[model samples]
Structure formats: structure tokens, C-alpha cells
Target chain A: MSERLTPHAPLTPAVLAILLSLAEDEKHGYAIMKDAVKPEFGGITLGPGTLYGTIDRLLRDRMIEETGTTDNERRRYYRLTSQGLKTVSAEIARLNAAVAQGRALGLIQPKGAR
Target chain B: MSERLTPHAPLTPAVLAILLSLAEDEKHGYAIMKDAVKPEFGGITLGPGTLYGTIDRLLRDRMIEETGTTDNERRRYYRLTSQGLKTVSAEIARLNAAVAQGRALGLIQPKGAR
Candidate 1:
């Protein structure tokens, strides 16, 4: 278990989505939002309040940090810190466990059976 | 996509855990809480406020329904509706996609490598 995840209780859906968006590359708030709306993230649409608030909290927690700033505030780029990566990894592990449990209990269909 | 999941946006962590707990068998609040503390649910501890509040909402949404009651109010058993099952299955599928994305990005270790 990642230390960050345990203390944080559970990451909000928006927080996890933002962290995953930054896993591969630095992205600004809008880019994170766009990525979150992709199928992998359950097509979630984050309102401005949620997007920026989660980003602010993540920044404060040192899970992510600003990588660059632009004249346009919306272009400020951010990336996951090592801590963020670890936390996200732990969360993915947790989600995988849930998936496994669901499978065992016959809640989820086997692969290719959908 | 499950209609319930979409309109509800994202299910709260408590809601998802409660739904999963009720998936296999009818359980009262205490039983659900016990199941939640098990490793598979990430050892979450839901307070009474969150537990019963979420249960009320799930009942309102028709995701779960009371099955039986004991002398003690805490022993009111609940089970997932077909709709609840579908919603939970959909949520598990979404989480699976996130896990797969994490793996593709090398955020999660491959099985047995942890």
C-alpha cells in the first residue's frame, strides 16, 4: 500500500483521472480534462471546480508539481511526482483487486464475453 | 454503459463498496462494513454517516433493496437489484480499463512482478 493513498483515504475520481493523465507526459488542466473524458476514464467530464480544486490539492500534497508556466494560465503544465506515481500505482493495484473480486463473485463477465 | 452509472456521474467510494458487498449476499449495514474492511475493498472504513446515507441513496436509486429485517435495526439485510448488478459490472469494467491503461503506461507492474 502506498503511504499517500492510505492517509488520503481514497482519491477522488477526478484526482485519479488527473494523475493518470500526467503519467505519460505533463499536461495542463484542460488536457487532463480531455484525457479524462476518453473511454478509459469512464468518460467523466470534470467541471472547472473539480478539475482545478483537485489539481490544487495534488500540488499541495506533492503528488504532482508544476513543470512549466505559460503566458496563458491555462497552459501551465504539470506532471506527476514520484510520490504521485507510487500513489497511482497503488490505486491501480487496488482497482485490480476490486476487478478480481468482482470476477470471482461473477459480477463481471470474463474477457471477450461481453 | 450502465444508465445508472452515467446519470449518477461517478459513484462515491462508499457506494461502490456497499454495492460490491451486497453482490454476493444480502447483508445489513454492519455486515457490509465488515466486508468493506477486508483487503479486497482496500480496507476502507465507512463511518455510520457515510454508510447509511449511501444506503439510503442506493435504495432511492433502486440499486439495492432491503431483503429482511431482524429485531435490531442494524440487521436490515439488503441485496443488489439487477440494475445494481449491471451498474457494479459497468463500474468494474471502467476500473479494469483504467488498470489496463496504467499497465500500458508502465504505471502498474505486470502480474507477479510486484
Candidate 2:
């Protein structure tokens, strides 16, 4: 696993969904999906197995840590570790720059955007 | 499918594997996995079907184009368009910034890197 990630092990969309959710604070399994599957993911939606699979990977990678227990239940809450936050921010920066480049070439238009 | 990617249809690892490969030059199926996997992807290599699946998506997105055909064996060569190069560059920049941020906090180390 260590060798697998040494050069680059990124957050899969499933993982990204979890990290983006935790970036706000913390949440258990199902709650993450509710938040993550907005108009953004276009309802492709993460299933139970997929969500947990990503969670397990992130936990193993130390990109996120178990923060606390939930009130209504004992569902474990995962929060982005310093490393995870850094990874997410970095990915966002890369995405932003790509968008900027597209704009420069008129390849992508802002269009009717919010 | 378009809506699914409208806000953020990023390069999945499968997709990234393909893009990174094409960034250097151009190639077809088996070759992309050979180059992309190296010691990098940790042998989670792209399958024959997976490679083409991503290639199709990239074609739809205009990130790659079907260049001239192969010589010895005709495997459709895929090349990164200008837009593709920009995306790859942006992604690399994002990754570099994240690495820099990690270094700033002493959270990640350079170690004995090659």
C-alpha cells in the first residue's frame, strides 16, 4: 500500500466526495452521500459499498482521521487530516488553472454561469 | 453524461493514466498501460477495456484526437490536443502546489527522492 501511494495516490471521486464533506466538519457514511451527491455529481451517486471503500482507503492513507462519534448514533466521523486538506486544495488549484487555460484559448466559455 | 461532468468531470485515475501517457507523445492500448503503470500506478494497471473506455471519454471531451493510424500494427493512436496538454499542466501545477504546501508545514518530507 505504501509503495502504491509513494509517487501518487489520489482521492477517487468517491474519496473526493468524502473529503469535500469532511472539509466542512465531520459526518458518518450516509450523510456524506446526501451532501456529496448534489447537482455536482449529477446523481451518479455513491453507493454504500463505494462510499465505505473510499473511506477505508482515505483512513489507510492518513488523509483523514476519525474525529468523533455521532450524537444520534455511534457512526464514526471522518475529518480531513492536514495531509488530506492539502491534497484537496492542490487538486482544486490544478482544476482552476485548467479552467483558466481553457478560457485563454476560448475553448471553454463561462456561459450563463453562477 | 454531459450533466454528470458539467460542474466537475475530472480525470479519474483511469483517465489520468491515459492523459499522462499521451502527454509525452501518442500511443494505443497496451502501450498506455505499460508507460502509465511503471512503478507509478502500483500495478493497478488499466485493462484493455478500461483503456478504451477512457479513450472514448477523452475523445468526447476533445482532450484527445485520433491521430494517424499505426504502422506495423494498426492500433488507433490517440494524441493529446492542446486542451489536453493544458489540462495535464494544470493538474501538475495543482499537485506541485499541494506538495509545496505540505513542505511549508513540515508535514511532508523530500526524503531520498529519485
Measured by lDDT, the strongest candidate is 1
Error of 2 at A43 (Å): 6.0
Model 2: colliding residue pairs:
none
TM-score of chain B of each: 0.85, 0.76
Quote the lDDT for A61 in model 2: 79
lDDT of 1: 0.82
lDDT of 1 at B28: 91
Listed per model, the TM-scores of chain A against the true chain A are 0.85, 0.77
- Taking all chains together, each candidate's TM-score versus the true structure is 0.88, 0.53
Positional deviation of residue B69's Cα in model 2 after best superposition, in angstroms: 7.4
lDDT tens digits by residue: candidate 1, B79-109: 9988898888778778778888888888768
lDDT of 2 by residue, B1-114 (tens): 354323224447677667766776788767887975653322347777888887888899888898877875657788988788777655444333333443343433443443
Q: Model 1, stretches more than 4 Å misplaced? A: A1-6, A69-74, A112-114, B1-6, B69-74, B112-114
